[model samples]
Target: MGDYEIALGASTFIKQAIDLRPDVGIVCGSGLGDIVDLVEDKQVLKYTDIPGFPVCTVSGHGGCFVFGRMGGKNVCVMKGRFHPYEGYSYREVARPIRVMKLLGVKTLIVTNVAGGVDLSFKIGDIMIIEDHVDFASMVGRNPLMGPNDERFGIRFPSMTGAYDKELRAVAHQCADEMGLGDVVRDGVYFYLAGPVYETPATSRILRGLGCGTVSMSTTAEVITARHLGLRVLGLSLVVDLAPVGQADDAVGPTHEEVLSVANSRSLVVAKLIEAVLRRITV
Candidate 1:
């Protein structure tokens, strides 16, 4: 917890410096950092300047925090995220969310790049995560599997309503108003601890389990946010298609490919997020 104290101090310093009393928090993934450009009165803070902050090394991820207004609401946006694959502990990965709670973030909007396993899904499509199956949990690892901090939350928090229902409805309504209803789909997301993409056989098994998309992150953050009593919403950009069966010429999608897809689809995602910001209340 001492390590986390260093991070908390850093967050406090940033909060004071930016005069940021954020009502909402947004976590940007892959090429989705462009949304920060839309913020008004932006104050940017580099992760390195913050105490105990883990800097991002992945390409397309800008390691900075932005504080500003979007759609008439005050918000803080993470232009990049720290992942477990980056050699950070689960607690370290979830540290930012805990700090966000301390900084008064009541709602969290998390976004990520995912591979479409559901045949009905197309590349560049956006899927709203209705629920998640944590493959990490089945493998004896979990973000919450640590010393309980009573100051933050209870020992056992109910995850039955992790994703806020009202917020999701508002997102759908916003999409409908923007004529993007067809592009917005709702489905279960499956998390696999990875720096590597899944194999065809593994993809098939996940698809059979009703997973529409697969990603390496998001679930840990969701759990942390929910434990802190924040209303959570997740949106994923489908960057590649997970085809079933072996092919002699088949090549797996690269991180660059994922970023490319995210870049192209960012326009739609930005619009959806901005619209939701304007329409959602508390």
Candidate 2:
């Protein structure tokens, strides 16, 4: 079956079950699945239960979809997301996003736990994605690399300002109101294909490239969302620090550390998201 048909199948099942047209879509990152708990009148569907969906194997990811209302807006939340490092192709990694588009999501809010490349970043800091460097896409591993499906989008979708400026402004305002102005900032997110954490040398290269944060996910999904004409807002929780200093013996980041930090700060991230959602105009 075609990509559109596959996405349609999943979205159709969701629609029939929830019977609600969501205006917003949310993808919760690692250790951040609790964000879905903020949703009211929730109806959940497991990934395994949804046809044409790839189940997430990561520990922190909940592997389900929660449909409900948040910030006075109807929304669909993905408790977990797929990744290329998980042995899924880019197309499969992007399926859930296309499903979001089919479900009538006009705006998408994506969140991820990332290693902070910028020295100024603290473990619990929130980085609003101003831009991104998709290393995977640059190397021909993009979600939209295959045959163009006109039904989903044009052959060439402009990614200029893919992270919506208006939505970002709303996020900043919400942050300020929550007194999180100091820790909340915007920066470039560098996307790398990773099942393994970065090496000291890799971290140095990312720093030289002007990346503020680095992670394995988000970019591909954002690309697919943009292709489907969805406005996007990306948030990165700095769960671990990238390797710094010239010392070769300096320890790098680890998954356990990332999850530990994410777990501690998940509530703050959830609150900020809720604030942003409340002010969003559909």
- In terms of TM-score, the best-performing candidate is 2
Candidate 2: tens digits of C-alpha lDDT, residues 1-282: 999999999888888888779999999999998898789999889999999999899989999999998888899999999999999999999999999999999999999999999989998999999899986788889999979999999999988999999999999999999999999989999997998887778888988899999998999999999999999999999998887766567777777778888888888888888898888887
Give me the candidate number with maximum lDDT: 2
Query: How many backbone clashes can be found in candidate 1?
Result: 0
Candidate lDDT (C-alpha), each: 0.87, 0.91
Model 2 global lDDT (CA atoms, 0 to 1): 0.91
**Candidate 1, residue 202: lDDT:** 83
Q: Return the TM-score for each candidate structure.
A: 0.96, 0.98
Note the residue pairs that clash in candidate 2. Answer: none
Overall local distance difference test of candidate 1: 0.87
Candidate 1 lDDT by residue in tens digits, 1-282:
463575579778887788868899999989998888778999999988888888898888899989999887899999999889989888788888988888889999999999999999999888998999997865757678867777778889888879888988998999899988887899999998898898898888999999999988899899889888899999988999985787554567898888988998887887789889998885
